[model samples]
Structures are given as C-alpha cells and as structure tokens.
Target: MTKSSGADPRKTDVKVSLIGGHRLAGATLHERTVTASLIGGADIDLTDVGIPDGAELRITKLSLIGGVSLRVPRNVRVDVRGLRLGGVKDDGPSEPGGPTVRIDAWGLVGGVSIRRA
Candidate 1:
C-alpha cells in the first residue's frame, strides 16, 4: 500500500499493487483517487467514504494485466470509461442525481468490476 497525496491529503493517489493485491477500507476518502496496478489486482471499497452531494468522485485506474474491483456506496451514479483489451463491468446504482463516481480506466489486458455496496 503506497500512498501519495495532492495538495489535499484527502484527495489521494493510491498505488494499489505492483504484482499482488491490495484493499482499501476503514478511512475517509475524498473527491478523487488515482490508482494503478500491474500483473496483480486491487479491491477498492468506497462505500464508507464521504462524497459531497452532486460532486463527482474521480477514480483514475491505470492497470495492465490485472483486475480492479470497486465497491461504491448506494444512491450514486457510476460512469466508467476507458480503453481496454478485456472486460469492464459496472453493476452500480443507476439512480439519477446525487453524487457521481467517474471511473477513467486504461488497461491492456485485465478486468474491472464496479458494484454497489
């Protein structure tokens, strides 16, 4: 678990894994998170975090040959976009209005799954 922060530590850059797996929980996250992986995976649960109303929480995923499983809170909109050579699934909420989570992901060969928690 390697972490770096922006001007605000709440808005963080989380390196999930290099060749294994990592999990994120039990913390107060902010509006944005940047994550990456290579030949491994990451499980990110954002259900317990605080996202401002109508604000968009950006999750930028840079991964290759690995998987990223994301669990978001309820009543939020999830938008996933990227270029990938594998599967990307989003089983999140579809309600209109409220907080939004934008996932920008890019990978050569892997999978990304986003679900509600």
Candidate 2:
C-alpha cells in the first residue's frame, strides 16, 4: 500500500524489504541492479517487479510465500533460491539467445514460467 526508495544510486546493488500486510502491485524497477537478495513474505504480493532492458539482476536468495513475478528483458541473468512460485502465470513471450537467463529455485515454483523477453 505504501512505497519508498533508497538513496543509493549506483546501479550495482539494491535491496528491497517488505513486511507486515504490505502488498505491492504493478511496480517497475529500472536500470538499478540488485546483487544478491529478493525477500518476500505471505503478506506481500510482488506481482510486478520489472527490470529494464540489459540490466543485471541477481537474486541469490529468494523467499516468496505469497507470490512474486519478475519481468526481465532478454539476455539478463537471474538466479533464485528457496522461492515459492506456485501462483504465477505464464503470460510473457520467450527470450532469445538460448536461455541466457538462468534460474536456481530451491523451494516451490510450481506454475511459474521463466520465459524470454
């Protein structure tokens, strides 16, 4: 329901934290690269976390209990761990270049599709 942005602006690393009955929808994060963590909870529904074209976003640890959807451009590398993506829908086009995007999910990503572009 409420949003806030950090003061750091280097496009190298970013951190997002959501807690306690906060739901985020249709939000976009561009040109800023996140290095190692994407944490979510049951009270948070990150249905729209989009990265710009040619931006590098790495999620070393992802803990999603409610839901999280990431819309990434083609050729961007993605890594996920301990994600529960059982409620995500496949509604995007496939990215080219032979799966240049890589995903590593350890928890439960049931119906989510990591398509290209």
Off by over 4 Å in 2: 1-56, 74-88, 98-117
In order, what is each prediction's RMSD in angstroms?
3.9, 7.6
lDDT tens digits, residue span 5-112, model 1: 555556565667677666666264445667677766667787876666777777777777766788877777888788877677877546778878777777787678
The local lDDT score (0 to 100) that residue 67 gets in candidate 2 is 39
For candidate 1, report its TM-score. Answer: 0.75
Give the alpha carbon lDDT tens digit for every residue of 26-101 in model 2: 2432233232223342221223344344444333223343233444445444444445546445455445432222
What is the C-alpha local distance difference test score of each model? 0.70, 0.36
